[model samples]
Target: MGNLCAGASPATDETIASADPVERALAIAKRDLAKGAGKWQELYSYDRSKLLGSGAYAQVVKATRKGTQKSYATKIIKKGQYDKSVVIKEIAISNILSEHPNCTKLIEVYEDKANYYLVMELVSGGMMFDRIVKKGHYSEKEAAEAMAVLLSFVSFMHAKGIIDRDLKPDNILLSDDTDSAIIKIIDFGTGEFMKEGQTLSAGIGTAQYMAPEVFKGKYDQRADIWSLGVIMYILLVGFMPFGGKNDAAIEKAVLRGKYALEGEEWDEVSDEAKDMVRSMLQSDPDKRATLQQLQAHPWFAAAASASESAAKGTRMVSRLRGFLASTRLKRLAMLVVASNFKAEEVDQLRELFVTADTNKNNLVDFNELRTALSKLGRAVDETELRRLFDAADMDGSGELDYREFVAALVGQDVVERCTTARHGAFKDMDADGDGYLTPEEVLKMMPPGSTLEEAQEMVKAADKDGDGRLDLNELEILLKN
Candidate 1:
């Protein structure tokens, strides 16, 4: 058998010459194994000289093991400073992933008098988020390869009944060299361990990437798949699929299950890649792609081959630079430029602009754009405003209409759903066979347990004309809310 231990250490240049490849490989791994303190006091037990960074509740310090002098990152979390349960959950998840090659290894975890310390592999390179921002967007091959690694780790976790609630670009850390990075799914404070036939009802995770089911308080491991979809979208398009004018708007959009992909922005991306993203981002959790399904995607297969070949090459810089300059990279760059914007607030502005434009024009006038931007905490000057319009107005029409606006704000599917829901809810609530719903009729449609006061409030809110009845426009607004 070929020597399995051939490339076990950074220092070693020779392949294992032993007759027993498996035994030799095991011995090689054991020899290179550098364990650190798995508990809290391991902080003082090592050199506390190198302080790397600090966060709201934890501080990461670069430390060396006493006996082996192996480098490690010691994350110290104060006992009362953060949620103890959350800290423990993160530790548990890290421990479970410790043995996976694609995962960040947790050396050890321990507790001292007032703090908990988690010793983990020290990834010298920074976060994938930082890399993407600096590099704009990655080549298809690079993005696919990185995604495959992450999917592998996530697949392993799912098989073990652990769901990584937090899946974002920031959580993925690179090694000393950028060529090989580990998808460190850190910050498992919101992670859930679900057994067969079990489900959870917790609305946790970042707002922009959260699924509709998450807001409805009905979620499971499939929630992770939704998050993966958002991540993949960002990886390809360099922006999120759902976001609205303000927090309320974003919440509404999410709750209503609005988001999609169509038009010129996605034209260059491969059909396989688009399919993979759509599969993951499905509004229904049951329809979202599972980890195994993702692994079998054509995109992953292509990426895996490229990654394996890249790993064997000696000139990493040249190889990566060539990949970055390829046609695929150029196409991805176009997508990135097409989707560039701040975040949720921009998403909201796009929504409002799309709504006000009404017609399918490519440019929104100053008045309409301002109205949208105002709802999202931004008031812009004419020049700055023009720049914003130019960024999203892909067709150069000098004014934006519904299709262009929706395309700029959220994906197409979301816009369709929002339109449908707004109309559907209004139709459903109009129960008296009249053209509209009166305050009394609206109250009657309320579920049995819904309080009388709550129903009255809904009527009051929906009665735009102050006549105790809701017209179609007023009813649509109420349903959106």
Candidate 2:
């Protein structure tokens, strides 16, 4: 559901032709969903009493999985209230995006006769709007950081032929209360997958954020870009771009494509920021900034400090060399340890991941990593580069997903953090608890269909004592190495 377009209602204005914008938008997204089907067979459970957010059909609540300290959010969908078809697609999308640092990670899905529950990574920070107003000042750098997350999300989804169909501040949440909280984009209620050259002819999104073309019901992914423009405007100006007494008035104002950009509120924002916002809010979809143009915009580019990049790149490359040199088992152990890193610590690493994912596929291929490294002046020999790439490609997926990237970014503090967290992971994986872990014990944690031999390979990589099993000390070494 990539298209986030305008208004909750259709315009009754003499100038408008469409009678229902929201319905038109939902029809496009649901029509797309009708073409695909899926079922979530995994079992999941959560406490339904601690509600985080709720609506007519579903309620999200805080949840805790047995034997783990991780906090999660579970969206419980009431039976007979919403179509099962929509539920399937939402779960499928969650599974697809579980690895992205910016998107919610769907942990499990289960259903009972009365409801369906989708448990996922919990976002603890308040809404983006609530945070800004409470903080009382929205800095340009902070706005840029948020924009970067949204742009990356949109770009990644577009690369996969998916449309968010609904992109607004309400659907975007933060991972925590800290200033560096990671962006967690949630709610794919109106998402759809599009083919090349496809167009959605309905405006299916919140009233104020909808693009003008969305109101006319003839638009593409760019409508989400427009919605982001609305968020950006509010971030800098301290008010919505198109304000009105009601949904109808907001719809009319959005259709007019007029917003304040020269008042006192706009005085502190950079011209480049204003330019990007203006381009995104363009009434003519064709006149809007292309995704490539948006990614390359000077507003975002200026946020990157060349000096900082060079310094960080130097340290990261050195870490890469060490990571590549470590045993395969250590690398595998680091993946589990990566999950144990506090969300705030991971948020600090996110900027590096986003910058390296130049193509925005939520992946950093060998070439992309090389190019990114070179750009940061941390170039290395081709042979060594291949070694590092091969080392970080944990699933042999030929690329480093975000978790793998985080594992490979180990420095002293990261190592200490992982060392402290390694015990819980070891105890969990050592299911038999004989004071040693066998390949059989670890296989439960591997991907589905992982072979006995693959698990053996992992254990052998760090079997320094020459035994076929590992003790907690070995697990610590495996994670810390």
Candidate 3:
């Protein structure tokens, strides 16, 4: 009755300030269910699952929709840890900038007496720094491609008066663990909104990537250009451009802006690439390359042209189709890449769901799911296999139900809505939003002249499972028909 799908928990009557975090999350969920207003309706539709990460002031946890396998990351911050005004500004900035393809999306916001919950898109791909470490090296072309993508996002955000004070590689994420995965800039915790001429005074960014003007405690949007330059240098060559043994040394080196491009790594690298980095790393904020100039630079243009030409000549589409057809991981990646699809762009996804649900039990288990993939043709290591399996198994029951399967492929809110008890529309008379229609509520909803016996008979007729009370599902059956 609470949410007829299996493993669904009933909403709690307790206040949102409960001692247990899990209980608090549930209380908020129930609160939203009773109201069912705006984005919170779908956000509260999910059950708070595993803890993703924790910081000094907040913790991020995974939330999965009850009937579907859709996944999202919810950042739960205690109200006392941050200033209320700053939190509001951060949320506003996130909402405004999230629409860009390269920026991480913030889906919904919810709050309790003690905490604020921010639900955002979950990107499983590792950080750019970690990826660079794993790969060990990159070509200038690769570096240019990554910079172009990052700069485009920065340009978009700056145009909207949002400055990402932190632009380190740790904040840049790949969409997936693939050679051709798209880049996503994340973690706007230190982001601030400023006008074109406004300058920030706080020293809030990572030391190694901080611009010289930032150390002076006053700098404009050009400060971000310095960080981008450092990122490009690190990506192209395998080390930081600034030579330092510690933070103090790094700050000194950054202030000097005298890093060299003389090394075996730079032997084959073009001078244009180094020149682009120099333009960004200039000590004077006024002299730093603007986002427009950076994007229009020859290196960026070359990368864009090469990318276009390769796309036109490549059979990567057929290969991508095979990759998606071969594994659940690849299919999920496809869904994430195509996460912004319109309603009409996803008709074929339902068919993909049917294909993955091979057992025809309206559920998909790990073995059956792996069997759907071309095991021999596409090799999946143990780590990735477990990640794919566990993510789809929302209930931890070793199987993905129909809704879960669809949510895993697309997104949590992308699936069609599940039926709720329509008869519970008289929630005012019920006095509680526990998905039950009491005899009193039935009387109120019934005709004005209806008798108690008639109301009892009505409840009896609607009670399908015979629990003595009419649940949402039973009420829905009687009312919807």
Candidate 4:
């Protein structure tokens, strides 16, 4: 038997080696670490400090990459204790929504003999509940705007066929410590993709946010809309729509849709907002407001217009840059933060990022950035400038890439120059005329300190097929994304 196994063909031997779970996992992790340039290396490169938190089956730790200085929340799960299928599914779902501004993106996944490590975006800011607590009381208009953003995100997910079975204030996180930071929906462990006419039968979700249909073991994506209603209610009035001394009681209240707006907090809230909540909290899933209907409602329309007006009024590049400098957010996280700013605000900052490109190399060095900021009247001291520039120069490139610059100053969602210069840039990275960019070629093209694994992950994300290489079509799709 041993001789037979050993004599297996190359492909068969590869398959047999991977049949042992530990060996399979170790191979994946080591292969990733060896690359030293991809997100996979993010796990090995980062120095883990204190434990961030623990869940029912996993624990998260705070980590900072050695060379890049980027921080990430690494969620470590014991491999033997959980369902591998569920973990894989959750990772896939997280990756699908990773680039969404309002989701806690899954940066990378790794495994060892005993544990599965999920490296994800670390939101330094606490939960939405914590924010509301810190403020003592929140304005109705602010709550309305937050809901608008949340609803927009959920709408985006539904359009992509994803359903966030879990939605609550605790799962909703503010992107940063700032009051105006974007709100992100986190913890997509219960999220699933559904096809047209499909209904989920799983009884999953927190009791308070659980739609009544969930108790009956039949539900659809609309269940998420109902949870949003509960969240909207709590956002306006600092309390849950359904509450009791025990889980059973809370579940009962949720099932019955037992909630009232009788409180000092609700005294000042508009009836229109309350009516909107009522529509969303409908006991019947069919009667509930879809994301489209919710957005088209007068409440969101008014609140959205108000938010746009507020954003327009504060569209000063100086103020925006000052905010960026103050936050001290990671360069990657800065991109998400930037996405929240108005286009005019981003356009003005683009001039700065461009002006900082003194050598016209499309990359900005520390001194060039400092000079540009000084010319713009936002001068920073040598120490602060060095710190800020270092943080933004991911990959230890010594200079900021265009995406990094936009992330630091412009905004997260701003298109990279690569979109317009696609072919030239793609060809430049291709190096050889091999029709495909190999790992070695990709590593050379990326910034310093970037891992070969990171480049591989980029290719994998855009590869579409299971092929290990990218073609021009794939490159365009990746650039657009």
Q: Residues 219-265, candidate 4, lDDT per residue (tens digit)?
A: 88899999999888877766788988887888788887778876544
Query: What are the models' TM-scores?
Result: 0.53, 0.54, 0.54, 0.55
Model 1 spans with C-alpha error above 4 angstroms: 1-54, 66-69, 81-85, 180-182, 244-248, 263-265, 301-481
Task: For residues 351-444, write the lDDT of model 2, one tens digit per residue.
Answer: 8889889889999999999998898867777897898888888888898898899889756445655455677667666777788989997787
RMSD, each candidate, Å?
Answer: 19.5, 19.3, 23.0, 21.8
Q: Which candidate model has the greater TM-score, 3 or 4?
A: 4
Model 4 worst lDDT window (10 residues): 1-10
Looking at model 3, the pairs that clash are 69-404
**Candidate with best lDDT:** 2
Instruction: Give the local distance difference test score of model 3.
Output: 0.64
Off by over 4 Å in 4: 1-49, 304-481
lDDT of each: 0.60, 0.73, 0.64, 0.67
Count of residue pairs whose backbone atoms collide, per candidate: 18, 15, 1, 10
178 in model 2: Cα distance from truth in Å? Answer: 1.8
